[model samples]
Target: MSVTAPSLPAELAARRGSTVELRGLVRDFGGGVGLTGLDLAAGPGEFIALLGPSGCGKTTALRALAGLERVDGGSILVDGRDVTGEPASRRDLGMVFQSYSLFPHLDSAQNVEFGLRMRKVPAAERRRRAAEALELVGLGGHGARYAHQLSGGQQQRVALARALVTEPRVLLLDEPLSALDAKVRVQLRDEIRRIQTELGITTFFVTHDQEEALAVADRVAVMRAGAIEQIGSPEELYHRPATAFVAEFVGLTNRVPGMVAGGVLSLLGAPVPLAAPSADGPVTAYVRPEDVLLAAEGVPATVLTTSFLGAVRRTRVRLEDGTELAVQHGTREHPAPGERVGVALAPTPVTVAPAV
Candidate 1:
């Protein structure tokens, strides 16, 4: 599968928040600004990821959408309806935080039923809904367990059940899996996607993990400072990054500083043609690690390092100028660091971003 990058549109803000549009949403706390005129959108049932570094306003956006953080300007909308001034209790939204946010005093079933109970649903119906929500998260038999009796993943599952039980109009997640273990995180990642697909609820997930976002989200919005850097499908963001930041952040990439002339790009004095977009200018081309193949006949270099990653081996090589690049190969012929090597790509289109 290939990943496409974002392209500069004729109307930059034309499609802003067409789904879950945020118009000039700004938030500031004392002297520190949390968000600045942020505009974002998510299609119905589309899993959108607000991805960025810590304190880059991803969580702030999710919080603002959940009515936890008040926007100083602009408005918030769900399915094109304004919910900017609506209180959290009045907004038809469900949220899962970085912390599980479960009531330690309540049992698993009780935690999931908390919202239903608050809404004054019939006891029989609330019990039925709580059980169904728990089953949705694969926590079926642990209904009576207290928070202390469940595993971290189980508690988070309970939290997921709680957020989902209300069947809210929109779903917001603030690094909900950040607190889980690696294995559990991967397990729940699939679970969250499955549950979201089953319910078809509009979701905005906040996370600093690129792999998680890329693996879980239909589209990812890479954020910088308080603004969105680029927004596109996982494939688009990975293979066709519009900026150097997205290229470097989305996947394992080897960024070689070079210049493009004509339709061919020259790297370390070698002639190379890109895959898709045609650019004839001075630019830097991006090559993914897996894209770098150890061809039978290519430029010779020395391997700096090699790491085994399950089926593929990631090898780092240094050019004649001591410049280094990484490639993942399938052959088990391990090369020691500093050993002579040769590398080239499979002649696929490459993404280029202007040098900084």
Candidate 2:
């Protein structure tokens, strides 16, 4: 989707992108751990997403970078300057939380001007900047509308405008789209990516939704146990996961029993190449649903169920030995439950974990 917003002012347009680095970050919540020696770095104008399941420290890392959370150990550096001891207001960062957090009494323009007002900017300049920011977020004529008067999506646009009005060195988004419905969430996320690209600002987005991270990030960092398990481009993470955890987390994966010998996995009745070296033994292969196809001649199976997903259809089939596998195919080919069919495994390289 294409998103068109008004051009930023000359001063805001000339804002140079900043580099950010998190070195050995550690945050302990007494008995609970938030971060454990986490390390990450972002280049100027880079968009990185921190993604993982609950309790993975993605939020903690973003909060620590924004100076909203104190670190037990480690340092935060922006543009070669250490800011570990700086306060949230002094960190020169902009953050948008999951909650709108807009003042009910303030209109859109005033809400967008809150940061500038706190910075002691003159009234005239603040007004001009606030108006420009509202225009930039596609709320140009709605500046007079209060939070209650605007829709949930519009309120979020206002919140986003508020965050960008100050022109901070880095932008931090903590589940900013979580509160919106599916359609609005998709639209707003695309708009956010477009705005971030136009501004050329460093951004860190925290989200537990894998699809969201994959759709709009230059690189995705998958966290586990308060530390990053893997960091790579969306395509790399999906096609060539470095670990079993990442293989299962980033996309839909089917665990098929297999035997490995000479770096090749014997899955079903087909021999598939291994993505990485594994000891020769019984193992569970991580396979993508698309890799399993319905064929006219292969291992015998019975269709258990099928789900129609937007452009493609995913069908679950049970093998003669009782192992269930999900196969993805075009919607034109629909197989009913209890229908006997032949299934085949494509010779794709797969990641595998030791058998339980």
Candidate 3:
């Protein structure tokens, strides 16, 4: 949000298919490192989301890749060309931020053409490109409306149109949906995905909302501290996280201390089979809330709280040994807070991490 507008270059950039490659890229801005040696390669026309909690270097990585932040180490290559030393103006990238900083004086068409004009694109060519961009965003008739005259969603679409009008090789989106409401956010998120796929331009998106990232991106890169913890498709990251940080960060997890010996793991002093058999000793069993299936043939747990959550009910149950687990069920079998119930895992993705 603190990004200042850079001086625009005066030349039209022909859009090209570009493969963005970041290898061991590091950036430090006085207060420790912003990004450690990180490596991620995004194919041409691929939509990748940089997902992580706050201060995890997602934004920092984005800025570096966009040429807004200087890289202190490693190289950044676009379309197989090493462009790490390129300035922000030199990088053929169109970026959208959480805040839509639309010009108050310029209408939708002019706003979309602003970048083209700054690049010294011919006035006639700019208009054609602007109209095309507005059409791409489903705002064809609103081209004459000023920013203040449009709705919030329309204004945001104008911003998208402006970014797309530039015809940049690569597009970068940084938490653009965070500024919108829940309903509007979902609507706009889907619209953005549609536009991206239509354009088939390589893109990098940054967001902390796992659901949003998983729903829209071709691949999700989960970051921790100043490093990338894991990067994979939505299904891969959700079903098979490479580390405990990713499992806990990407989704809701019920972590319980356990010890594994041979193929059977002991949880709360009861033997339970894990999805994978691992070496013996102390470990943490990570069971998702949805995985905690309540059945008559499972371990008994005392329900501490039951919350009716529409199609599903969330019940926090306390084991006899003082361990608490959350069980998510689809049926309306509402158990009282202090009632005892049975719990087990479902047939979906089940994983357990080593105990720290």
Candidate 3 per-residue lDDT over residues 1-356, each given as its tens digit: 11122222223222335798899988887886588898999987899999998989999999998898888899999988888998988888999988899999989999999999999999999998888778777777778999889878788889988988888889999999898888888888888887777667899999999999999999999998788898999988887777778889888888888887776777655666676667888888777888777887777888888888888888899877788888888756888877778876665544677777
lDDT by residue (tens digit), candidate 1, 277-316? 5566677678888877786576688888888888888889
Question: Candidate 2, clashing residue pairs?
Answer: none
Considering TM-score, which of the candidate structures 1 and 3 is the better prediction for this target?
Answer: 3
Candidate 3, residue 20: CA error in Å? 0.8
How much does each candidate deviate from the true structure in C-alpha RMSD? 7.6, 1.4, 5.6
* Clashes per candidate (backbone, < 3 Å): 10, 0, 1
Best by TM-score: 2
Candidate 2 segments whose C-alpha is farther than 4 A from its true place: 1-4
Q: Judge candidate 1 at residue 181 and give its lDDT.
A: 88
Which window of ten consecutive residues has the lowest lDDT sum in model 3?
1-10
User: Which pairs in model 3 have colliding backbones?
Assistant: 283-355
Report the number of the highest-lDDT candidate. 2
1-356 in candidate 2: lDDT tens per residue? 23566776677777778999999999999878699999999999999999999999999999999999999999999999999999998889999999999999999999999999999999999999899888888888889999999989899999999999999999999999999999989999988998898889999999999999999999999999899999999998998898999999999999899999887789996789898899999999999999999999989999999999989999999998889999999999999999999999888889999999
